[model samples]
Target: MANKNAPFHPIIYVRGYAMTPGEIDETTADPFCGFNLGSTVYRAVPEKERQPRKFIFESPVIRLASDFGYQDVYEEGYDILDPEWEADPDNKVPSRAIIIFRYYDEASRLLGIGQTPNISQFADKLRLLILRVRELVCKNPANGIGEDDFRCHLVAHSMGGLVCRALLQNPAAEFRAAVKHVDKLFTYATPHNGIEMVGVNIPKWLDMNDMKNFNRDYMAEYLNIKDAFKATGRVDWLPEDSFPSERVFCMVGSNRMDYEAALGMSRTFAGHGSDGLVRIENAALHGWRRSGKNKGSAGDSCAKAFAYRAHSGFLGIVNSEEAFQNLTRFLFGDIRVDLWVDVEQIRLPKPVQDEVLAGRKVSALYQFEILASPRGKLWYLTRRTAEEDSVACLSHEEWMQAPAQRQALYLSSVFLANRARVNPRRRSLAYSMTLGVRVPDYEVDRRLWVNEHYEGGYLFRDSIILEMVPPKAEGDAWQVKYAWQGSGVSKADTAIDAKLLGDSRMEVCVPFGSSGSPGMQGQLRFIVSLWNKEAAGN
Candidate 1:
């Protein structure tokens, strides 16, 4: 039933919170529990009033079915979760299936129990679901699935991500081995650090539908991060001994205005830099790797991406093309590229330069933005800007400090070579990244200077598109081509290649500077490496 071994593991979808009874019922009523719901709109698409809409990406469930031939366990009007549902001898469940972790079913009156279960119980159900899926996949003898080789990928949104985390990080005595069955995790707009509103954490007293489960203190208890939380004041972390955070991909949402929950009041409470319900800063977890500066400190953060999508809606992060693309690639991609920015120098404007040259102190803040996307797509995989309140900002003093003193600037990582390329004839994997630095607000002599300032001005902006052709045979030379957008120049025009660092690694040096004026000068360094190639193909 399966040709591939690593990447095609069965995917189990864990849905988000059902804050109220009606929402719980609505989720319970659905067969796939909203995992089957599709979206017709994306962040770049205009409002519904705009016509000639040509883009309509189906739900993740349908996409998996159509693209990868994954099927559900529903048969005879019964799901695998149903006790009465028995395996059909004539038809065996496909090894590659999209199983929904319907943790909320027990909470609906139409289903089992009428009361909603807390997050702990939800984790319990998740463990059982994995084991249950294992039993089903192993049922068919021809499938050749065994307990030692069977694994599942967990795709979750919001609180559902926490459920899986609960299982992985800490499970009940009965389900302590649940972590062994999970290979990778992908979270959509999950408040890994715990959800906050109005600048305060969700209170423990507010127990509506167990909303208090989001309280940081409470989460630390169930997730078994109490000591970590006390030491770091955060519950967003996965113990390396249990599961490395690098295996978790977090899709963080940036648009709060489109959440529309509570008639847009939720956005107001979440304020800016949020997805209405979850703040952007709280949407991802910290990794386990420690940095060189100190041992036993958090370093090499968990993989995460930012999009303009909201928490959950037509514009939600879950149902959007951006999220779907990320989810699939992280699960099955063969190439992983991590981007880093090294500022060689930050030149000032003519006037600002003159002030600095005269020995007068000048203070300024620089906002850096990066937009990354794959080939043949209009949407971005990871986007960060000042407007999104997620951009990397550096003060002039910070820039003056040595790179060693300052924390390394990590833009985002992109996974590729999973979804079959559009042009099978072309054997190269390609993508583009746009890096821009906004003109800063200069303060000479500690006083704000606005005389020559113009709003919405950039110090430098350009797109670096890369085309990587894999080695035809082992030890053969791998070819790489690159160019800056709108420069009237490409590798096709002038044959060029990236500087090869070593085996399985390539570095593309893209230098940027303002024309005819004193401005920023730096080169973006991209390190592309082979992630998991066993499943890579056209």
Candidate 2:
């Protein structure tokens, strides 16, 4: 019988890039190649007076084994790969096996001739690996799985993600059947659009040591998506026809300071708007032009989450609780909530409001910071800060225009109902979302301008807790309870009569206000939709 609590397929881990010879040697020496790396960290208390408490994360590999009864597909210190092993019908691999792609071993001096092949070759090897996995796991009648029922999840980090995409999008015609065996793709800090060093994309001419693999031009040629690139930006590597985008998830890192790679030189060159190495803009698979025109087709944007993590090292994105939670939930969770914000109106300070109304050429820039956390968790599932990560920036002129121009800004996707954490008594999923509205600075007539002093660098900041209970009856809709922070002790504690727009869509208007600060008011209309899991192409 299949384990209903665990993921229904095997997991293949593809590690990220190894830039230097030493890095390559280190990766080849490790059996798991950093996939089993663990860390001990601390969380900063909101109050400065309190000391941060320690937290231990026993790695994703350990968690999978301990929490879901998954086992590593290894025997006698070797991974099981040969088809001959199937001769012993009793020697069958389980469905919940973790397999590591040791692609770098062939390039390491310790293992091979130290001649690294190009990514395309690695992709071809991936195709063969999937076929090998299917043969070992599916052909065994003892496993109680049919050949067509066999599938695998590809979880890759950095360049490994590109490798997975290369297999899915640009595979040889003869190896096309390999793509069908991939159930889903999850990437951690992969440069889906190719990495940028400084302000320029890695130059195609800098092919030394195969660094050109990250060049956009080279990527366009190899990934076979030349038409997706415009003069300014490029579309995602995975095309909709090859693999449904919703089945892919991109976990983006935003913290650049903590990455200690190259003695901190990597962060210096990668610069701002990056996770030490990969820029936030290149971390996601969604396509966009310089003019902000989304070239990706409807429903082609993959699910993504942003965390305050570096590209690699001690504070790596893959080694974070935020990333781990997102990974497991996306793979096994039953409920998925895609959250977006709709600004009905943005009110400026009285003085600035008057100046703008008088047509005094007043210009303002606003930054929106968003963070989400599960009900009992102190840390956030996703975090986007104004100073560190990419934030929604709007100008005064843009704010005054119709809401249609602003449209809706997608924040993040949160998955709930993981079998490991489901509470039968609660029968609901609860989360808290924090939004901060900040005006860093303004300009008047192309000159420097200042605004009224505000605490926390934000004009408005509030946290809203939402509880969603699944409907009990067939026609009954989901029950939603929402209340802003501080509403618990005030009269604002009231359940909203949220209309179920569809089977998976709901809208709620959250009141925004600044306590003790008059003339500041607005409402954030949140459009929440549950993703169609079946159609998600997993």
Task: Tell me, by lDDT, which candidate is best.
Answer: 1
**TM-score, one value per model:** 0.90, 0.88
**lDDT tens per residue, model 1, 1-538:** 3334567888999999988788888998998877777788665532334443446878888998898878887878888866657645665666788888888888987786888878878888888889888887778775677776677899999999999888887735566566787888999999898888889999988887798888999998988877677878988877776687778899999888778999998999899889889998899888642324453457557788889878988778888888888888888887777787767766677887888889999888788899998888888989998877777677787776673442347788888873557797888788888888885588899998887788888888888887777777766666777788769665422335566678667776666667656476676777777765544541
Point out where model 2 deviates above 4 Å: 1-7, 43-53, 82-90, 235-237, 287-300, 357-360, 400-406, 418-422, 451-456, 489-493, 498-538
**Model 2, poorest ten-residue lDDT window?**
287-296
Each candidate: what lDDT?
0.79, 0.75
Which TM-score value belongs to model 2?
0.88
List clash counts for every candidate, in order.
Answer: 0, 0
Error of 2 at 426 (Å): 1.4
Reference-based lDDT, residue 403, model 1: 36
